[model samples]
Target chain A: MVVAEFVSELRARFGIEFKDLSILDEAFTHSSYANEHRELGISDNERLEFLGDAVLELTVSDYLYRKFPNLPEGELTRMRAAIVQTKSFSSFSREAHFDKYIKLGNGEEAAGARQRNTLLEDLFEAFCGALYLDQGRAAVIKFCQQVIFPHIDAGEFRGISDFKTALQENLQQDGNADIHYEEVSITGPGNARQFNIDVYVDDKLLGSGSGKSKKRAEQAAAKAALVGLGVIS
Target chain B: MVVAEFVSELRARFGIEFKDLSILDEAFTHSSYANEHRELGISDNERLEFLGDAVLELTVSDYLYRKFPNLPEGELTRMRAAIVQTKSFSSFSREAHFDKYIKLGNGEEAAGARQRNTLLEDLFEAFCGALYLDQGRAAVIKFCQQVIFPHIDAGEFRGISDFKTALQENLQQDGNADIHYEEVSITGPGNARQFNIDVYVDDKLLGSGSGKSKKRAEQAAAKAALVGLGVIS
Candidate 1:
């Protein structure tokens, strides 16, 4: 679509009337296209992607911080990472129809770069970066509220690593003196070692698991305990 | 320091008189102490660390995005990593007297956990997290301005992997069109192979380097080119 269509669609979709559309132009412009048309002096979206990445992170972090007050740091960290990964952003890009406006070099267009997940992720971030530049932090947050938060609030991105925290909150022990994780065994080669851990309460093993690392093992065990306790299905 | 002393000193130092001093109390309380005195019903600072870490990152990222408008994402990532690492936060904690306020269990205190770099880092983050909760986003940003930004502005965190972007910006060419990096050779075992790279500008070899990976080699070459061009000493 044309720039006017792009501007109108953005307004209709996000209520954002960008002051400087040139930043969005840069956002939609890919490195491949920019390289092919260097004479036009159009810059790529990589820088915007960089800045937009941080913007996205902060937005998501703030959302998670406020939304899930009881979740432990480990769970929040995992959720944030998952929310910002290529899959999530790419999906967000597709939903926002940002995929329709990306400018690609002739070769890249033929090579199917238009439908790539990583590219879409970059576009989403670049778009956010441009939005941040055109508007500010509030604009970005509002945009997320419209575009991203619904998915989050509907319980779409739940159940990654908060199991340990869930188990603790279920048992009313705060990952401290009340809860105990015992290392049952160490197995496998040094480089690829696996740890078996058991989560205990009142000196009874409530859950057990083995994983590639101690932390992972502990988390898995906690998840099992949570399930055994019927805290979550 | 006692809570009252901590309160008075914080106001005197940061011009911040928190409405909820309990937040700061939680920030200063370590898990060890809370674990030992379970009946006190006091929570530790881990959650605050988690939130504060994100807050610190956003604060630093916004600063960098504005301050160094020309820096590439790679350089920004490296610089951000350095600034948020244990050493920097530990030093910040010590300087801000956060180290003096930590409430550790007797064993941890006896084992010198008070001076441990990791502990100090957590304290710094927890402190920021507490400050953020007590104040809000603007307060956190302002707190960073008083605490972190000046050190950043002093040119203390330089000589990171921005050489390629620096070289290109110095040459007034963006990353895509004007600059090129060619792989000269690869040697050593599969896991430990080294790459030799050469960077060119206007068909002239400006710099060359060898590194464990292609990106590193390119960055080294860029640094060399920047030095050869006398852009940065």
Candidate 2:
């Protein structure tokens, strides 16, 4: 797609548009296209993708860290990983109608590379890279808040389960009750330490589990308790 | 160490110090320490590590993306990985005297976790996370510039080899001449395509090599050509 139409479409769709269409155009320029059109000296989107991946990491991480304040580090990492996967980023690309604008080489175009999740993911990251380079992190974050954050907020990337929260809410449904996790046993060495934790609600044991860390064992205990309570199958 | 001493030492060593010593203290608090003092309800550094990892990723990526404009995505990724490794980050932590400030539980301290590479890396990240939270990205970047980027600039993370530039400089020692890479042969199907690329300098075939992608093949060709010219061993 040409720069003018892309800009107009962006304005119409999102009420935001960049003045330097060439940067966005650079984002749209796949490495395949650059390789084919080497004489034109057009910059490909790979470097942008690199920068954008970092931009995406920081933005999404900031969001997750704030939004899921109670979530442990392991769960937060898992959720962030899920959110940044090829599937998730490609979906974000489709939400932005990126396929309509990406300029691919004839071979790649014929190979349907535009529809591929990896390509789409890279395109989305490159788009972020372009936005970041043009306007900076705030602009990229604003763009993310528009197209990416909403989906994440809607639990589209709920691949990682937070069983602890569910269990706590289930037990605290009627009123505020104390819940605690205790390490019942620990085995193995420091590097491969295995911890077994028992979760109790109001001094009543609900479930027990073992894992490589106390946090992981607590999560497993919570999950088992949740299953026992018929909250999850 | 106490907060005041930490702050004073920071200023004395780096000529800069965070006003929020409490936040810095939080960054130093390992989960083991928090676990030991559960009643105190102090925060662990894991969350900060999460945030700081992303911060470090973005800042380092920004530096690398700008500094090595000619590097392809693969090389850039490898270099970034090298820069973000536990060893690299632990060394950065040591450079900032982080080992002296980290707070660990009695068990962990007795176990010598303070000197561990992974823990030191996490401490470095947590420090970045705290700086980002107390100030912002600019502050975090400034800290990185002070403590981390200098080592990277000095090529401390030179694990990833870059042969293309060396060969080009070697060929262009006297004057500028056309250097080109041409696709010579292809094998296998689309999913397993192997490409043979030949590097030519002033109509002379310098080297030929094969790989999964044209860029990889080109790099391989460059490496081979460099080795052939005794530029690299």
- The prediction achieving the highest TM-score against the true structure is 2
Reference-based lDDT, residue B232, model 2:
73
**Tens-digit per-residue lDDT, A1-233, candidate 1:** 23788889988988989888788899999877865664585768877887888888878888988887756677788788878899999999999999999999887899899999999999999999989888988999999999889988876777646666667767875445478889888888643567799999879889998876555677889989988888766
lDDT of 2 by residue, A1-233 (tens): 34577788888987767767788899999877875675686878888999999999999999999987777787789889998989989988999998889998888999989899999999999999988888889988888899888987776775437778778777888899798989788788654677798999889988998876566788899988888878887
Model 1 stretches astray by more than 4 angstroms:
A160-233, B160-233
DockQ of 1: 0.24
Q: What is the DockQ of candidate 2?
A: 0.48
Write down the lDDT of every candidate, Cα atoms only: 0.81, 0.84
State the fnat of candidate 1 relative to the true structure: 0.52
